[model samples]
Target: MAVEKLFESENFLIVNKPFDMYINSDDENEKNTVTYHVASPDSHLSSSLFPLHFVQRLDYATSGVLCIAKNKSSAARAGKLFEKRLTMKYYLAVVRGHVAFEVADIEFNVGVDPTTADSSHRMSALTTSEASERCLQSRHAHTRALRLETGYYDNRPVSVLLLKPVTGRRHQLRVHCSAVGHTILGDYTYSGTRDSMPHRMFLHATRLVLPLPEEPLDIQTAEPFFSDPKFSSKWRSDTAYYKYRNKEDFKGVCDILNKSYVIGVQYKMYKM
Candidate 1:
């Protein structure tokens, strides 16, 4: 599978990463990865000009905008932006159940589940009391949810959520959404089963904003698979799936949040 380039510059490259592709692979023989395509001398990009480095990671099943730095200095700058919580990461997800809150901030502590014997370690959400008792090295995770649209598919209620994660913890969005009783559709790990889920996970990294040295880099990607008629047919005709068709709608969301942030700049700026 070819990686789609969304935007590129002297300092960095942004690509629309497809589902099931790794940002980087552990094995040199593994050729199906974003790094391989961008860094390979034989590939379309000039490998020497931009020694690509992944700036952010997405789950194997998740799809959306991924940033790659051209050099060590650019990578370090981007890392500092993320560390300072100045980077804005937006995700779109179709989840089960009608989400009650129009907007909410979910705060949960995450820790590795010791009982899982599989190589793919599963992270568990710890209750406040459990967090204190276990004394496990836990990280606080935060996810902001905005209800973009609502509809039903196959007689089951589902909603599309615009999620902004403040903390970059593993499976933070998945766990927080589930903690609020709305698990992302097709998330077998958190939602229990993928029996009725779509072929791909519903989560997509739709937009990313980073404060670069030159200017703020606002990169966006169209909904990878959700906008396709094949997926739309499953939803009701009057759902948000139809309303959120263009980039303008996404921009409107950002604008509204920006206006809100202006009032509480300190705390709201870092959140959605």
Candidate 2:
């Protein structure tokens, strides 16, 4: 229930939401959620900020920068940015394997999982051709993954990746990562029984960039659990990793979208 207010403006309220908490719940009796915490009468924020309109959502297991519009006007403006795919979102994750590509531009059409049970939620990543043949409801999803570090977690090879989602589809990052054969750790929904049992999912929404008129907002949160001894260790300190980590030059182009996405990963992380 502890949500840290990161930045607040007249039109927006940015907060670092914790993991394992719902953004909101259908059951009014559920007081353990982000909405309740921010809107509660006793909240530290002003009462005028009541009934905060969430501009976006974070999965129950995901934690990081979340934007809340203080009013409907602001919400509408931000909503348009999201719909137009103008917002930039970055996430950090510890996955189950050493990723083959140091830098990759991944494109997959994500659709409802045909294999998942009716009660659970799952998404499947398919090639453009495969999606048309099997998944009528599939939507285009794209993500750029940059491997920051590779190490062992509990004797198993794991990779820490900085992910940028070009298109915001439900579970796009998770589905794309899993499709690459390196499911994010503790992602039981995608990793299933083979994944480890971390205290929470190893995925976090680390940064968000919104191109709002006049003044753009770029907010970021520090690494939540990447350095914990329980999660990773014995990291490889190759000079190449440092080169990319230090400079801002890892780039890639997507043939599917015919667009180039160049991102600089800045992380001072090493585990011994």
Candidate 3:
């Protein structure tokens, strides 16, 4: 188990996740799971029995930082925050199209797709525009995607974006980015015609803010996978992924919270 620990506390520990890893794959696939990769020998989830509880589920095709609860009590509390839509999740991505809109809140129904089992997840469901409005009003997971830069690739523009998801849906960031005409780079499920990456989707779960007991937990961390240039160079140019190289933004946010998360696994990843 080679898990890279980002930050550890009595309540939770954040780790950098490997690409192509499921947060919680079934036992048959545990060897390829993020839990199996976790380096810490903290006896599963809590009482030396269950596996650690994963509060947030980053898409299997997506890779980045993840929060894991070491104990059952903390796990329950953190899970509630996520379920109640109190925790804020952010992702940095390169979408396929340049978004003209600076910001927009998307409302849609997403469920299992009866079609291709080739895809691991279900796509969007059929819902009326009014019903979509109600979905937004009730769930209140507002995803704001900010366009950073755009470039032409084969006569198409790929937009670098910062996504802030106010609520956590199964694949909210991917779907929301897709719905807005800018599906994430390397996204297979939401691709328009025929374009994808050899690796998982190009969305990184760069930061998380969870409400804590004292002053409300505010922990910001990045996937070590993003810190390296070679890993990014596999598909896109440096201009698209350079923001992640300088982790000053994460440190700044950590300072605001007066909390710092330490890196557990600083693996010297080779470029694939």
Candidate 4:
């Protein structure tokens, strides 16, 4: 799979990560990971910056903007930004059920099961008592949602959500959305077979805001799965729910999102 470069500089690189590929895999034989592709000899990057480092991670099934550092020093600098929670990560997800509020925050205690391993190790929301018992290890996760639109998919209620994760835990948005009875579409682990699922996970990491020493880097990726005709066709044919009839309308949507969330930052949009 070809990785699409969004932005590139001497110190930093941002790419549109494809769905179903790991940002970095533990196994050396897994050649399809982002790290592998970026380090390939045929890649545009210089061999001097061989081991490009990922500042953050997106799940294998999720697609969107990913930040890569050109060198170790740059990676360390970017890591500090993430540690201080100075980076604002935004996601766009298609979920089952109509989310009523325009803006809302979901807070929960998320922990991974110690018994499971590999992809089977699923994260779960712990009850208050459970969280208290394991306070030392468990993490407090918070996700904020801005409802973009509420529409119907195959006569079933579906909503487009713009999610900002205040705290980045594993699967924080997915677990929070599911806890609220509107699991993300195609998230079989959380949503179960409650409603019809999309062909792939409906969550996309739409944007990232990183505050560097010089300036803030705001990067965004064009909606890959969100605007797919296969998914949109499922919406009610009579309504304009999921329709982007032309390029102008699509650009309008992008402008609205940029204006609403990413203010006063040098922003760039990348293709996938």
Candidate 5:
């Protein structure tokens, strides 16, 4: 499936990024550039001379709403919003098993460690140090997981969650989920699934709230929106995943998200 534009303007644009799609063109191979999809008139790729500057990043496995700053001024303003913690972003994730509830407010930083090439959200780090060229490299790190929603899987609840990042780091969600002992269903690197997620990994970046050009602006939000492929389901499952069928412990993951988001609402405005 090609990239889909949800909305665009002189100041901003929102694109529906597909699973397995790379967000940045600098790293995009000829086969999968976001610009190629937007540049061609065939798809939602727009024909603006102004470039699409990505404000935030999502892992290749994740999907859904991504904001782009159309002009340099908006890009600068939006960048500040993210840095100042004034932006509100939300994600919907499908995790393994059922959630036992009441574990939300899971806060921690995600920092890189030279000693360990790997990081897990398990909040389970036992630190180590490395000396490279007479320099010591170390970091204090921890992360948390909580149940957000328990949707009906034949009257049995399945864990669906809204993951909020306190300190964004590479593979934070996957690492965190893996740390919790309940890895995401389609995650192989984090979950230790021998062969996981035939299609793309099952994470989505559902919502983003952008502030207006006007100072102290009200929040503009995009919600429950998906610009999926035209023949989405026809895509075959390409990867095989290991199922850790732990249905008993997961329930009502959404409730946790709502509670946490409500608490954090007064913090900031996030827009591109």
Candidate 6:
């Protein structure tokens, strides 16, 4: 349960949180959470940044850039950015089928599924008719997906997507992806037992931007699975079969994203 420290300053600390680890757990038996490692006496972060205050949360099965505030004042400032929906979050994911659209916006309402026995823990997208018929607890979720590559995973068709969640709701990305018939690979709850299980979920939070005072805090983590020795053998990029409908538009989008990596201000051009 080691956390990679990505950035540290007087007010904030950003870390690459490993997948399959909880941020916090009510179960006393659990010791693999991010909070446990950060508070451990043996950890380097214990003395300087104890009593951790997380600005946002990543799912237990998702990994990447996670932000933590060093103190209360910084926490309040960072919290405002999130509350105002001024922060940007980007994620990388591999899904079950070839994504038809090169770029499309997925908007739907996500809520607890009363139809299933696991309603308490499982979520589903409520269709317009369904939403109007029932008074289920739900929220409007919006996400923009950019298909990066179409490929084969363990001989089954899959697509690599860069996801931008415009509105943060519980399991927004997962629910939206599934609603459009491309449930993320290795997402057991959404895809069910039909798809082959990978070592871990194929979703990773690749980048985060926090707009603070004089300068914005931007942090990025490399896409983990693409180069992973364990995952490479099973992944095959299919450049021949799939082609973008609008090649220039796709290329332009990629260029903007790449430029944003180096010139931080360039990200605003693509931000929705």
lDDT of each: 0.74, 0.71, 0.59, 0.71, 0.51, 0.73
| Model 1 lDDT at residue 81 | 94
Name the weakest run of 10 consecutive residues (lDDT summed) in model 6.
263-272
> How much does candidate 2 score in TM-score?
0.80
Off by over 4 Å in 1: 41-50, 117-120, 131-135, 194-196, 237-243, 257-272
Kindly list the per-residue Cα lDDT of model 4 for residues 190-261, writing each as its tens digit: 765554446778888877888897746988777665468988778653223333334345444444443543
Rank by lDDT (best first):
1, 6, 2, 4, 3, 5
TM-score of each: 0.84, 0.80, 0.72, 0.78, 0.64, 0.81
Clashes of 6: 0
Tens-digit lDDT track of model 3 for 1-272: 35577788767778877666766544544576676666333335344454577777777777777888877788888888887777776667777765664444455455444454356454542244544432332232346554444655434567766677766666777766765567877788777445654345678877777876753665555544335564345434323322333467544432322322234422121111
**Candidate 6 deviant stretches above 4 angstroms:** 41-49, 115-119, 131-135, 240-272
Model 5, runs deviating above 4 Å: 27-29, 40-50, 113-148, 151-158, 193-198, 213-272
**Candidate 1 lDDT over residue span 1-272, tens digit each:** 88889988888889988877877765668787877876763232334454566778888888899988877888889999999999999888888888766666677786665555354446666655745443245687877777778888666888888888889988888877776788888788876665345776789999999977685799888866556666777777335523454687886775544333233222321121
In model 2, pairs of residues that clash are none
TM-score of 1: 0.84
Best by TM-score: 1
Clash totals, every prediction: 0, 0, 5, 0, 23, 0
Candidate 3, TM-score vs. the true structure? 0.72
